[model samples]
Target: MITKKPTNKRLGEILRQANLVSSSQLEEALSEQSQTHNRIGDILVRRGWVKRETADFFATHWANLVNETEKPLKQPLGHYLKEAGLLDDEQINTIISEQDQGKLWVRLGASAALKGWLKQSTVDFFVEHLFPEQASDSPFTKAKSSQKTAKGRRSWFFSQMK
Candidate 1:
């Protein structure tokens, strides 16, 4: 059977919900994915953290992003920073490559550090720095609670309908 392709936002939410990624990590990956046309799973795999088959399975199984709460960011690091008025692409690349040796997570930090997207010394500097303030300060809270509350909420919805 053909697998359904979840929207980028939905994919991020799923990963966050599954505890596979923190909200901040998902956000960074999503932002990075948008620019490169790479799937979120692909990048994670490239980072040596996730495997391809598992990603494919998740991609095939989960629902799409039709009702996602937000849009996914996909701009390449340099372009994204430049658009944000943070730093030019070349400068961003130089720092990220220099700092992380082209590692995905490190590169994220490099880009942020170079462009001042976030401070250099932050923990996992690239991963946690610059998390959006509006993200309820915890990106996947809803996703986690939903799993626990699913059966109860569904019953409530059905009772109301009847």
Candidate 2:
């Protein structure tokens, strides 16, 4: 008997389930993809229907959940957070500025928590939900919470004045 293991959901399905991209947006992107021979994510990004970070998140996690023969995507964390409605682009940009100005690099999840933009537990939930395969071994699992340290915080004044 040729038995087949269940296939993971497609990128569009994953993005929709996560509430990252609307059905119309996905359809449009898919249509564009058919004509351009480009990645749906790229098409969505180019069309400004979905942010690059959001597309990357779906592509990366989808790749992780699929069979090894498939290629994995290198996506950002912002998409998952955005899809979950824990954070938005403005918040992410602020966090990015902070990280860029900080003496030491800080993780996005930790920065969001420190800024009261998102709860650490919420970040954990999304991380576990999106990247089930890597959740147990990732830094998110080890930290147990956002990284809190004086050095980790960015100086708002320093960056603003510059």
Q: lDDT of all the models against the reference?
A: 0.44, 0.58
The TM-score values for the models, in the order shown, are: 0.32, 0.42
Residue pairs clashing, model 2: none
Q: Candidate 2 regions off by >4 Å?
A: 1-7, 62-162
- Which whole-number lDDT from 0 to 100 does residue 103 have in model 1? 38
Residues 17-81 of candidate 1 have per-residue lDDT tens digits of 54445677777787889899887888776875444654554465333322223554332323333
Location of the lowest summed lDDT over 10 successive residues in candidate 1: 123-132
The candidate that wins on lDDT is 2
Top TM-score model: 2
Which lDDT tens digits does candidate 2 get at residues 1-162?
112234467777676655556788888888877898898878877887667876776577544433334443233456557653457767876766755666325567767877787666655545555444445544423233334342333342234334
